[model samples]
Target: MTKLFIATTALATVLTGAAAAETIGVSIPAATHGWAGALNYHAERTIARLEEAHPDLDFVLATTPDSATQVSDLEDMMATRGIDALVVLPFESEPLTGPIKRIADSGTWVTVVDRGLAQEGIQNLYVAGDNASFGSTAGEYFAENLDEGAKVVVMRGIPSTVDNERVAGFEGAIEGSGIEVVAMDHGNWNRDTAFTLMQDWLSRFPEIDAVWAADDDMAVGALAAIEQAGRIDEMFVVGGAGMKEMVARIAEGDETVPVNVTYPPAMISTAIEMTVLGLTSGAPMTGDFIISSELITQENAEDFYFEDSPY
Candidate 1:
């Protein structure tokens, strides 16, 4: 419950002092897309503010393009930096689990963010967006907005527990609601993959009443394909993760993008800040911190919009 404020000019001397006593390493995925880009932006800004607030704390941030690189980054952080704590968003669940467990076993406090590890109890703290709410919120929109038995297609993200929870929540929400999912496939959270998959679904199904692209990147691809096929007017698309462009469209009353469910990239800031507080203030931070998702409509889109944000 400790709050960190930006330090005033009086602490300028600490700015040039020796390295801080505690080192917290942050390893996250590279800015491969809009969502990840915003995530990186938030992480960096949070670390910067925390650094200024507490000169006794140090931070090491690494962005990895893949699981292999992320594993290597963790290894190097453990061996060379001798980080006292770690905040990691695993590239994938399975491959990074053992390596992260090894780090935890070595007495390092681990905080897992967003994508979870395959094995539980490995992290001292867990911070992430509510994947189930991310899905169910979108599903509820579909159930209320679409007609009974309306057909739709779904695009999933990468294979992980996060993706699984979202899909499961969606399924549970629409159960017996008379909404039918005509087709579903993995878009891997990539725009191109979703475009290709959407194109194929268009070819097979004569009618698609709506689309749940799940992530904003996949939503862009689905929209492109839908527009290309000249079926833009036939169905609307609902995506999660609150990409700035998509929220803007929703604000502008774009029919194709009527609404968005939020899974904020800023959750990284929560994890980093909490980890620092636990280390510096001796506060208890050994538990899950789940940030809830909300539905973004034109009525409140401006509240979620950030003009300065990269995503």
Candidate 2:
């Protein structure tokens, strides 16, 4: 017999008059960057708190380095743990759709966070940061601050649905603003990758005015490149995700790093918490839970700053 079958049979014999424990499986990408590191941090803490609070809820957490590993992790969770629910942040949209759909099809409640699946209606609860607003907020700042025909570059994150949404929002916001995007490329949301991409853009474009490093980690890389090129004063940068350091710089009225957009990595906590609540409390948790994004400027940066935050 399968382990799940054996365990269920044994539990039924031992707990004839008691409630059985339910399991939740959480699978996400490994901490490949600063934002992802923060995500893992929040997920771990949330899981610990929930496990302690709800003794009948068992959690199986897995961090995968890539989509293939994530797929394998899900298979193991199902085969061995017999999880009742699943919470996932896909490494990439396309590769994970089939695997996650299969899980959902097996009657396992699915809560998708951050990066969405390629297929729709597969997840019971969807929790994520406002990716479109995250982009548009930064775009609005660039539109208001830069002159007409000002040249700028962009650094995008890993190719996923959220990245697409953020870029679309940014493009739509700057449609008629006349702030030209001279170059755009993927930074994979890695500081080193962004640093290299920014270096290349600096060498090719001599008159760049601003940068929209879609992520704060990329912004740091781009800033380093700009400084190395001695072009720090010529251009400013806008990045999303209120990394504490980035918010601090904005609060101090730094000219090169003036503003930021909020895309908290802690949204993973929301997904895990809501999923557990839905399973245990029978509350209405179906549907999207989108947290809105806000711009962080010198006037109100203090409101967003978390001095003890890891991100």
Candidate 3:
């Protein structure tokens, strides 16, 4: 009787262990830019946290620089590893939709983060930041801080739905505010490109009140150009994407960078958590999960500041 009881206990332990083990696959664009780098950092950190908390869960993180590469990575992950769940932040909407849809159809749980798929109906949960709100919030800040008739220059990102939404929201906010957008051009979301664009705008325009580099990476370059040209007092620059360096400036009450708009890269963690919740607890989750974009000002800078973060 004693031997039989011991055998039953061992079997139960093995069954519980098997039931607890779970696998998750994450695919994101490679860290070619500041925002992508931050996303990579947050993804790794979140995976570490989740793995520690759930010992039986295994997470696989894959990053690709382009749409084609990402598709290939996804295929390799699915074929070799047999992922139970997948969390993807695609490089482009159209190229990724069909491939991701096929993964979902294979009975694996799917979580789409950042960019959304064009075809839809595949994602179990979708998590993304409010790109429009990111721009609108910055516009509102500019409207309040600058004079009514202040002239500003705008530096944009790579042409995409995300960029379009931000530009639309920003323009909409400043429409009747008497703030004139003197120049608007694409910076390709790069520091050097933004620096060059700002230099040209400076040369063309005699008096500029402010500048907005929609992304922090470009903002850093814009600041460098302004400083190099000895035009620090000529304009105040505002950059979105709550990068660690910019957040620090806000914390220090830097007048030129008094406020920043947040488009957090940590949002991938939300997608991961939602995916896990659905798989483990049978939780119902679907549709878009839009994270809020809050303006990071001196008053609330501490809230958004992450000291150890690479971004």
Candidate 4:
């Protein structure tokens, strides 16, 4: 956990000239779920747009399905590609830290997106959504909607710093509010897994009043499960991320999915854009840029919906 801050003045030397040919390596997770699919879509779009604008700049985008593949892909980029900079959205924190840090040590400027490496000082710039706000926002919604002493279940995503931050934010917001969290489990941010988890919840908890699905995919799964069990009338579910389907539900006034929180996958665009700017803008992009999470309700669900989006 070393703190190696990049000074603004020092980055000017690393900056590539606008007219010169430059290469950037981008590593991201493969589209494993709804949010990640949107993330990949935005990354590819950004890469295409940037290439169109800066003909001299080449972006080498690689998507990995797991940490091992991500690590190997990054290594390949370092060895074969003459990349001046790297934009990485780590597949997993701990496993990818060493390879990512190696890129930095090789004198390539690094911009990390979404999930951060376990070790600090590995990347010069960091960008991600507000996991704390993501959690607490949904928790507040549950607190307001549910009756006092109501039984609630929580479905968590994969284990990571983001997951911990979100769960902490949620529990912090609902503490002592009489909204008892009767059960909590991992959904792994996958629809099928979340559906199975929700199915189990239905079988076990006969009188559950509400559920906080920490992600949009999980919320969709939970809704499907509740419908199958014919308990849609009993519990209201809260999910994060402004997924098109979930937003549609909110817009349609589907009581089963009462509300949602915003955690858009488009933040990858910001990280990629910033990385490109850092390379050619002759300025420092050497700090944290955290995207905030906001609540999505039926009153403004249309604002969050994108009809063409796959997620």
Backbone clash count for every predicted candidate, in the order shown: 0, 0, 1, 0
Instruction: Point out the worst 10-residue segment of candidate 4 by lDDT.
Output: 1-10
lDDT of 2 by residue, 116-170 (tens): 7888999999998888998888888888998999998999998877789999999
**Residue 62: error of model 2 in Å?**
0.9
Evaluate all candidate structures by whole-model CA lDDT and list the values in order.
0.89, 0.88, 0.86, 0.85
Question: Judged by lDDT, which candidate is best?
Answer: 1
| Candidate 3 deviant stretches above 4 angstroms | 1-20
Q: For residue 118, what is the lDDT in candidate 2? A: 81
Q: Which is the winner by lDDT between candidate 1 and candidate 4?
A: 1
Alpha-carbon RMSD of each model: 4.8, 3.8, 6.1, 6.7
| Candidate rank order under lDDT | 1, 2, 3, 4
Better of 1 and 4 by TM-score: 4
TM-score for all models, in order of appearance = 0.88, 0.87, 0.91, 0.88
Cα lDDT for residue 148, candidate 2: 95
lDDT of 4 by residue, 172-238 (tens): 9898788999999999888899999999989998899998989888888888999999998998889
Model 4, residue 259: C-alpha shift (Å):
1.5
lDDT of 1 by residue, 24-85 (tens): 89999999878889999999889889878986776788899999999999998898778899
User: For model 3, what is the C-alpha lDDT against the true structure?
Assistant: 0.86
lDDT of 3 at 235: 80
